[model samples]
Every structure is written in structure tokens, then in C-alpha cells.
Target chain A: MIENRPLLNLISHLTLCLGVLVVAFPIWIAFVASTHAPEALNSGTVPLWPGDRFLLNYAMALGLETGQKTLNVNLISMLGNSLVMALGITIGKLLISMLAAYAIVFFRFRFRMLSFWLIFITLMLPVEVRIMPTFEVVADLGMLNSYSGLILPLIASATATFLFRQFFLTVPHELIEAARMDGAGPIRFFIDILLPLSRTNLAALFVIMFIYGWNQYLWPLLITTDEHYYTVVMSIQRMLSVGDAEVAWHLVMPSTLMAMLPPVLVVILMQRLFIKGLVETEK
Target chain B: MMSNLSLANIGKTYPNGHQAIHSLNLDVEPGELIVLVGPSGCGKSSLLRMIAGLETITDGELHIGEQQVNRLEPAQRDIAMVFQNYALYPHMSVFDNMAYGLRNRRTPKAQIRQQVESTAEMLQLEQLLERKPRQLSGGQRQRVAMGRAIVRQPKVFLFDEPLSNLDAKLRGQMRIEIKRLQRRLNTTTVYVTHDQTEAMTLADRLVVMNAGRAEQIGSPLDVYHRPQTPFVAGFIGSSSMNFITGRLDHHQLQLGELRIPLKQKVDFNGEVIVGLRPEHLHRGTDYPHRIELDVSLLEQLGADTLVHGKVPGLDQELIVRLKGAAPCEPGTRLSLGFHCDELHLFCANSQQRIN
Candidate 1:
């Protein structure tokens, strides 16, 4: 970037293009295969360009067409399920973590640091580590196969709590004293001052938690036996394994491409806020 | 409308058993400005915070108007404070920052707007009302802080070293502006600061505090002219007062290799710590007692030059203030004299002023 030599520029651009190709070529292949007819994909030579049956393949993949009765998995409802679970987990995690951080930081109580450390200790016990016990708890509560089961198990985030706690600690104590002098009660101060001040952090965390919720395959795969509750990520795995039958590359590719959309949209929408939250501490 | 503020036997002891303020008492009339001035850890700020209701008064009562506010929350105490950092809400616009209190109190919308706009006008912050605190300069932020406090019209205004964060010129400007605003409003205000100049200029009554106690409290001039304690004498002046241990016998005060005839006889004096202001020492033996000093360093302040030097036998350096660009060089001996009555004598053990 500093030196504007022709050779250096060409070399850097070539390296960047190669890196892009390394990351994007597989997604490009998936898009091309999703557009082609099933016969063209079964011919063994992968198509480099998109085909003419793009709409038909996508329509069948979305469960709108009556062409294939055997693979009649409705992707639209799965999309809705993913959206709900994502939103639920994002909002729930943000609310619970922000309140926990607020209590840990601003209020004085018994076992304060003990509570914080208890939450902090859960960072080591992720969903995978405590999956069996968590699943048992969810099953006992009769929450399995429900939206609450998918979202609630993943809602309490120790990282977000720790992040918010550190952010709140950086906030000047004078602001709280000033708010108190201004007759703002604790709830009012939290709503008006603390919430707005933490906007970027919230946005950044929303994008992350939403993506995490959207891509959840293991938990949903374990809990949901009903096709009605299956998320897009869970359906992708179900689409690939059909006992002895051949994999439908056309349907699977389009569904895979569709599954990537919501998370991508979220990132694009909150890119500015996410970058700002990570880079700068806005006062 | 303003109300008088009084603190009776106010004290603060932390839960960890460290006492910050000990049995402090003051009564500020409705329009008076009392400045508590001291160094860091002197408990001046703790006393101010106790009055503001930010910190609890461990032992005594605080009254704003007729109500004893020991149990009242800061909001219920009906006082506003301007902090050293200005403590403006960074996210809120200047207008919102000033209007937040009134809004929280649920004043009518139109009345809130009127109050905020008028307060902004008084602080000359009308144009910058839409700007956030980060967008404004330090002086503007300070004015916004002041405007926020003024808009509330609290019974007592508390300023916790409000102008200390500004640069020298801005601090001076804000200092005058604060004085003007306080005079116009005539609100009882308790201000805490470590700067002696601010204390001397801003206070109707100055409280010089040291080691968790109010060493002296009086008019600035009264405290300056007649400091009852050695700590007050040392802390009140621009340049610290110099102290020298000397002997006082009968009507004669004897320093090392120098003797000055006393103007008035004291009843009892064995060993006395003599206090002298730098400006009190004049050059060339014009009045009475003369002392020959060896020059060590010269600090040339424009209007007055302070010559720091040492006498032949005294352990401490003596500074003499000479008027207007005195062509004095460092390492040059100068003869200086002071009047007999200019001497301040304190008991060496108790450090209490004797004469």
C-alpha cells in the first residue's frame, strides 16, 4: 500500500485474487450446480456457468412445485423456523447478558464476584460439553421439538455478558451519579443511558448470535424428529442422506445456498456497526 | 428561589474502617458560596459529596432548606452537581442533556423546552444545543455542564472541581463566568477544589481543610491575613509561606545569626516556627530587621521576581519577592528586610499560630 510500484501492485492484486478464488470457488460451484438440471449435474462434469432451469430448481427446492413427491421438504417453513430461533436467541441473549452485566457492575450485593465468576466459568462449558445434561433438562421440561428448546438452550452467553460487563465498567461512574442527581431511577438510567450508549455492542452481538442461531445443526438435529420443526441447517443434512438413494445435487445445492442467505444479509446489514463495535469504544 | 444549606457534625467513615471526613461543620447562607480547598486526600471532596448526597454522611445531619437530608437519595435532596470531567451524557444532545432532569421529573413538555432553551441562552450554548458532548470543545462541554445544572434550579448547587479539567485560559474564563452566573442566580453553592487561587477568588467564605478537618474557615482576606493554624498559612497563599524555627525570649525574636526586635510582647514562647510570605520581605533594609542571604535560584515572574536563597545559618531556603524585573542574578547575595509585625509565630509542637 505504501509503495505504488506497478510490479508490487500486480503481485498484491494477484495474491488477493487467488485468496478470493480459494474461498469463493466452492460457493460459485454450488451456485452453478444449483441452477443446472439434475441430469446435467449427474453427468459427473461440474458446470462452470449457471444453467437455464435456475427458477425451476429453486422452486422445487422451496417446495412450491409438485415435480418430486419423494423429496417434498418445504424449505420456506424451515426458513421461518431458522429466523425465529435466530431472533429469539439473539434478543434473549442480549437481554439476559446485559442485565447480568448491569447487576454485576453497578449494584452491590453478596457473592457479586462469585456470581460473575460462575457465569464466567460457563464459558468453558459450551453446548457440546454439557449437551447431554442440557438435553436431559430440556426433555424433562417437555420443551424438546419446540422453538423454546432450540433457542433457550443457546441463549445465556457468557462471552456477551463479559463483553457487556467490560463495556459497562468503562462507562464513567460520574454518569451514574449525574443520573441519580437528575432524578433518574436505576431502571430509567439503564434504559435511557446504558442501553443507548451500548448500541454498537448490541448490534455487533446481534449479528453474531443470529448467525450462531441460524447455523445450529447438531442441537436441532438431535431434538427435532418432526420435519415441521426442522431448521434449514438440519434439512441440509437430511437431504444428503437418503438411505441407499443417490444424493440430489440440484436440490441440495440450492438449499445449501439458501441456508447461507439470512446470515449473510444480517452481516451486510450490520457490517458498519459490527466493525465499529469491535474496533472502537464509543463513549 | 434558593435555600440555605447547613451541615452539622458531618463525618464519613468507609466500611473498611478508614475515616475520610471527621466531624466537619458549616452553614452556608442562601446566597453564599463556600469553597472547600485542600490537597488530595484532604477529605474536601468527600465533604462536598456528602452535601450533594452522593456519599452518605456516616454520622451527622445535612440540611438543605428546612429538611434534614441524611436519609434522602441524591435525587430527593434536590441538588445538582457539576463534576470535574463535566460528566455530560455523551449520547445525548446538549438540549437533551440540559432537559433530562426536567423530563425525569415529568415537567410539562413546553415548560421543559422553555427552561432548557433559556438556560442554553444564558450559557451562550443555543447554537450548540443539537451537538453531542463529544462534538463540542472542552469549554463548550463545561458550559453545557453548567447549563444542565442551572436549568434544574436546585436548592443547592455543588461543583466538584468543575473547572479543573480545562486549560489555563479556559479555566479562568469559565471561573469568571461561573462567578457571574452564581451571583445572578444567588443559589447557595458548596464548591470543592484543590487550587488555592480558585478558592480565594470564588468563595464568599473559604474553608481550608487538612487531614480530614477544617483547619480554618473565614473570608478569604481574613484567612489570608490571620491564619489560625500553620497548615492554613502554608496552604492559602499562591507561593507557600516559608517556615523557620526560631527562639523567642522576652521582647526579642532571635533567628540564626539574625535578631529582630518584637513589636509586641508575647506571654509565652519557648520555640516558635516563624512564617513569612515571600512578598513581605523587602530589599535594602528599608523598614527594620535585616538578613543577609546567599542567592541560590531566581524565578523571574514578570510583575514580581522571586529570589530563592539561603541565610548563613538557617536550614531552610528563604524566598524574597522583588517587584518588576529586578536585575537580580542567581548566586548573588542580597540583603532583605521585613517589618517586625510581618512575622507570624507558631508553636513548634502544636503548629498553632501564636501571634
Candidate 2:
């Protein structure tokens, strides 16, 4: 029984490594594809070594892809737009959710339970079921082609509120009492004591919201009809043509890789936050 | 203000209709450490929370230092609390946690540092100031909690079983530390604990509560030696006082085949509980109204023996704490003495102390 301990530890380590590789295979393959030329990719030559075309393909992918009419869709401008949209959603959601969660968790007002239920009820409804209605609502509000239409609906999701509410419930009544005794009115207590105590949840929620914002394709696509409003994912989708003029794997693969940069960087940079946040929350 | 502490007919009924505390009246002299001793669900903590402005009073006046604070937020009460869990803001360093209130009050940064350092030094927490709550020992965390209160230099200090979470040895040690610190600070402190030993050792005055009502408020010795009610006498002592139920036939305590003398004249009771403290039992003296008993169990401590036995027709049992070696053996009758001077008389019907 004792001899198996080292074997168990080894198995765990290897399993974790395998998990990382599995999650990362697509990115690695995409980067490998970017290194090859269009003919090499389409001709079905398996690329084993790093190809010389990486920088060349990157330069082309960084530029606007030329259409049959010779017009172009910008790469960097779309990235900036995507960033603005993501920031809007992430920050807006956090504020609304924090306030809502605080009010739900601590306050003693009328219809408190009812209000919480109303929010909880939203979790049962998928945005896919209401996409048409939501689109009409955005269009009617003249928010089409604007960031608000892209951000607002997504920002008001019940996840953060539910998550933060769970976190605040754990805050000892004594800490709340200590805050009040120290003269930290409700607002002050929420900000100074409760919020600081909730870093783990905040970090985890931030990563979740960031990935959701970055990977956005369908909603941003449905809402923004203009090329100028395209996000990174939207730009990559537009690169594929309907008629099959000639499929260039070189451009498409690099473009897909380019689209993943922000989310990848976010996950790596805030991995510590994301892990700690979720860990603290489990308590 | 009116006085250091006062509560006017305070009460609490939770939303679920759990009546945690009933109409409770209490007053405290300045710098008095009033320990509220009660069993679980007695509403002592709830009453303290109401005074600390953590909970709504539901109905009644809560005054601290002459100011009615029923409407005030916890932070506005000028009071500081040391909780059972310590609640030391686990994420914060000892310095920041202790200095948090001063900073909230907009004390100058230099002043905050000085005050926090001074408080830390007083608690012997200077070396541990850099550590978070998770890093400190339970006793150290308790001290930091005290430091957190002291740095505020608040009008009143409220402790809600702050030492209850510690180990038995640590609890005893911190109990002494807290009493010494309270004396040094001399601020009006109200402490709540269920431990009779704690209530006995630390309080300037004791408030014994039961079933959401204050049963008695007096000095520790006063509550122990001269409890006004049977409940107080029973609740305040470790082994608990025993009461023998009997009728006063011709004003004499009439047990079956046993007649006990009475020093106080009280109404004859149809039913009553007699209480005797273990320390009051003395060996080998006989007088009028001597009773015979058979011993069933004898528990020996280093200092005394607790003789447990049943007398005929008593229905229940009797315990006597005898000093040195006791001559009484199991299933054997030995002569022991009872003096009327040491007898406490209570009304058999109401269970109220008559003597």
C-alpha cells in the first residue's frame, strides 16, 4: 500500500501535464499552421519543422484581407473595438452584480427574497431563446452598431450576482458588526470589508467574464452590421468567403491564432487570481 | 449621558417569531465589567448585539454613555467588539486590521501608525504585526482582536465569548489577560459568556440570564452566596445546588423520618427544591433534625470527596462535598451534621429564596 504512494503522485503529475497538452493542442497546431505557406497547407504537406513563412504570414494577417472588389477589413482596428466591448461588459457586469449581490446578501428590505428570485429566474432563460426579441430591443433603441447593444445585455447576467451573494453570506455577522461599530455605514462596509474580503471570487469572475467577452462571436455578429464594428472573431469569420474562391489556410490559421491572443494573455496573467478566487469561494 | 450603560425594556422577536430575548432591563456604572452568564438560547448574545447596534432592538431603548443608539449604525455607536471568532479581517495584516477604524475616522497617517504600534506593543503583538490572522496562534489572534478594539479607544468594549473558541488552557490564560487589560483600560466593558467559571472570575458584577430574562444582577460573591432565586443558585455554581422538597409542618421542614430546623420563616410549601453547595458540607457534627442517608457513590478529588446517595422517601438523590477523608461508605450509614445557621430557606411553591 505504501509503495503505491509514489506511483499515485506520478500519475497525478502526468495527468495534469496531459490535461495541459490536450487543452493547448489546438493553439499549438494553429501556430504550426501559421508557419507554413498557403500551398504547403492546402497541398497536404505535414509541417514538422518551423516554416520560414511565420513572420510573412503574420504581416499579411495583420493587414486587411483584400476582397474581390479590392476593399479591405482592418485587423488592428477590429482588435481595439473588441477590447472596448469586452472592457465595457466586464466592468459594467462587476459593478451591477456587486451592488445587487450586496443588497441581496445584507439588506433587510421589503420584497428582498422576491427580487433575488426574479434574478435567479433569469438563469433559466437562455439568450439564444430571446435573441430575436433582444435584437429588436437593441435595434429599436438605436443601439445597433454601438458598443452598448453589444455590452449591456451580456453585462446584466445573474452569474456574478449569484456568485457574489454566495460569497457575502459567509461573512461573519461579527465582522459586519465590527464594521458598523467602526462607523462603516452599509456602503463603507460593503466596499472596505466585504469587497476586500471577496478578492478570490472577484478574480475568478473576472477571468470568466473576460473569456466570455473575448470569445464573443454570435451576439457581436448579429448586432454589428458594419465592418467598422467587427471584433477579432468577426474579422476572422469575414475572412472566409462563401463561393470558394480559393481557401488560404495560411491566412485563416494565423487570423484564428491572432484572434486568441487577448484571452490567452488574460488567462495566463491572471491565472493566480483565477485559481485563488475559486479556492476561497469554495469555503 | 444618563450613565455609562442603560437599557430600557429591550426586547427582540426574530422574523420567524423566535422570541430570542424578552423585556430586559440593565444598568451599569462606568468602567464596570458586567458579565452576562446564561445557558444556550438565553438571548445574552442577542441583547449584547442590540446594545452594540448590530441588531434592531425590535422594541426598547438602548443607551450607551447616555446616547440612545437604537437608531444608530454599528459603526456610529462608539463601541468596539471582540467576537468569538475574533473576526480579525483575515486578509489584513495585524497592523492594518487594528488601524482600520482609526483610518476610517480620518486619523492622520502618522497617528494611526503610532496608535496601532502602541496597541500592538500593549498586546505583545509587535513582532506578529506583519502576519495575517491565519498565521497567528489562537491566543495571538485573540490578542490581536483585543488590539483591534483598543486601537479604536472606543466608549465601550463588548466581548461576545471572545475566548470560547480557544483551548481550555488558553481560555483560562486569556481570561486572566483580558481581566488585567480591562482593569488597565478601565473602559466600561460588557462581557457575555456561558462559563460559570468565567462569570465568577472576571466580572465586577454578574448578570445571570435565563429564558430571555435577567434573573439576577449582583456581585459574583453576592450571586453565589446569596442568590435571590433558586435558578440563580443553580446556574451560578459548578456542581449546582441541590434542593430538597418538603412541607413546613408546624413550621418545621418535614422530610419522611427526618426533621430539619429552619432559621427563616417562609410560607409552607406544598413542593420545594432545597439547594446545598458542595463546599458548605462539613464533617461529623450532630444537632436537632439529623437525617440518615445511604451512600451509593463517592467521587474523590484531591481536596474533597463528593458523596452521592439517596435518603429514603426523597424520590431523587443527594450530594455532599466532604473535605479530607470521609468516613461515609457505600451502603453504610454514617452520622453527619447540619446547622440551621447555614440553611438557605426558599418558598416550596415559587422556588424563590426566602433566606
Query: Which candidate has the top score in DockQ?
Result: 1
TM-score of 2: 0.91
Residue-level lDDT for B205 in candidate 2: 96
B201 Cα displacement, candidate 2 (Å)? 1.1
Q: Can you write out model 2's per-residue Cα lDDT over A81-195, one digit (the tens) per residue?
A: 8998888888888889999999998988999999999998898876777789999999999999988888887888688899989888888877877776666678888778777
**Which residue pairs in candidate 1 collide?**
none
Model 2 docking category = acceptable
**Which is the leading candidate under lDDT?**
1
Task: Give the RMSD in angstroms, all C-alphas superposed, for model 1.
Answer: 1.6
Q: List candidate 2 stretches off by more than 4 Å.
A: A1-28, A44-49, A64-72, A242-244, A281-283, B1-3, B13-19, B58-60, B267-270, B286-293, B324-335
For residues B77-150, write the lDDT of model 1, one tens digit per residue: 88999999988998999999999999999999999999999998899999998999999999999999988999
> Per-residue CA lDDT of candidate 2, range B1-355, in tens?
1139888899999999998888888888888899999998888998888888777889888888868988987778888899999887877898988988898899999999999999988999999989988888999999999999989888888999998999999999999999999888888999999999999999999999999989999999999888878888888887877677666654577766677767666656455556677556556555544556688998888677888887777776878887867667798875556666566666766768765
Tens digits of per-residue lDDT for model 1, A121-238: 9999989889999999999999989999999999999999999999999999999999999999999999999999999999999999999889888999888888778999888888
Error of 2 at A199 (Å): 1.3
TM-score of each: 0.97, 0.91
